[model samples]
Target: MDKKATVQKSGMILPRDLSERSWERIGSSLRELTNSSAWWLADWLIFGEATYGWRRYREAIERTGLDYQTLRNYAWVARRFEHHRRRDSLSFAHHAEVTRLSPPEQDYWLRKAEQQKWSRNELRKAVRASLAEQTRELSPSQSNGDEKQEVTQLSESAGADKRRKVARLTIELSPGQLDYYSKVAAAHGLSVDKWVTQVLDAAERRTA
Candidate 1:
């Protein structure tokens, strides 16, 4: 090894490797990357060198007749470093908060929270194990809002022979419309009626 050749670690830059021309290019690349909110330059620098090192190791192994598995392991390590670096850039926790739920449920929570602007505490409360106790008796559709749902229970028609009557309304939907409804409903795990209500509610809120 040349005494002047600096040891490069995975995902890091060494001052000794900078030629005047390379230093100027790096400075230019950094400025462009920073302006575009591409903050993974540090990660790229580290991974890029690791990849070069892996190629060198493989060549040396072949020349010296060393174990193929050892070189393979080195390649795997380099790939893993790249994977972790990209994932870390996404700012996700090591263990997701809602890991027990289905993937769609997890996506729903993430998107819904972002759309509704929920605070961390509010998000935790909304998805708490005992959510029913804290939440109002509304369908999943109605619970889409960030605000607390209001309950307006009326006294059972006091002394007027308390009776509850149910009303049913039916409408015909075209095959294409029905398909669209099913697709939307399946995405949210809601009934078609619930999905329609949610769409209308969101529209109303946006207009308001």
Candidate 2:
């Protein structure tokens, strides 16, 4: 059968003899849909259903014609970063890579992703590196007296001299406040830490 006839009969976009023009058009349309905010509609639906109950979540996923894995990724992203900043420039794949991390580690790798313009593969590598570093830091061998002392001394020296060079400041915020700041920072193409630093520096300059 011809391409149009096959599509009309089977309601399938994919056909062995599909025309190049038709294929390109379909691809473009799908890309546009994925790029639009509509892509998150499934996420919101999944979130609502999950809040109601597991049965409802499963039913909604089926009703919406979304696969479980895709819905699961959205749900995971929502729960993981519920009170954290999300970068618009980063795709869902990027967020998915860091979902297994602690909140602070999530922020650390995400910030690196933003600064480095990492592809999803690159983000995966960064996450792996971060995990390795955490594992090394938490090793029992590092807890011995001499090693602990050395670590303490090195940490103290780093804290003292590094602050002079990079100037670290600590501030506590409610979850809501942190989320808002994160959104603002991501919008400006800066991580929360870098954004806060720039804001402080700007204030200092104005005062000066």
How high is each candidate's TM-score? 0.26, 0.48
Q: Lowest lDDT 10-mer window, candidate 1?
A: 149-158
lDDT of each: 0.46, 0.62
Q: Which candidate has the highest TM-score of all?
A: 2
Estimate, for each residue in 1-208, the C-alpha lDDT of model 2 and write its tens digit. Answer: 3365234554555777878887888876656557444337545765677587878767766887867786665666767765346766676677778887546557767887888999889999867875576455333122334222111110111355465333323455555566677667666755455566667678877998
**Full-model lDDT, candidate 1:** 0.46
Worst 10-residue stretch by lDDT in candidate 2?
148-157
Say what the RMSD of model 1 is: 14.6
Please give the lDDT score at residue 87 for candidate 1: 29
Query: What's the C-alpha lDDT at position 46 in model 2?
Result: 57
Off by over 4 Å in 1: 1-95, 133-162, 165-208
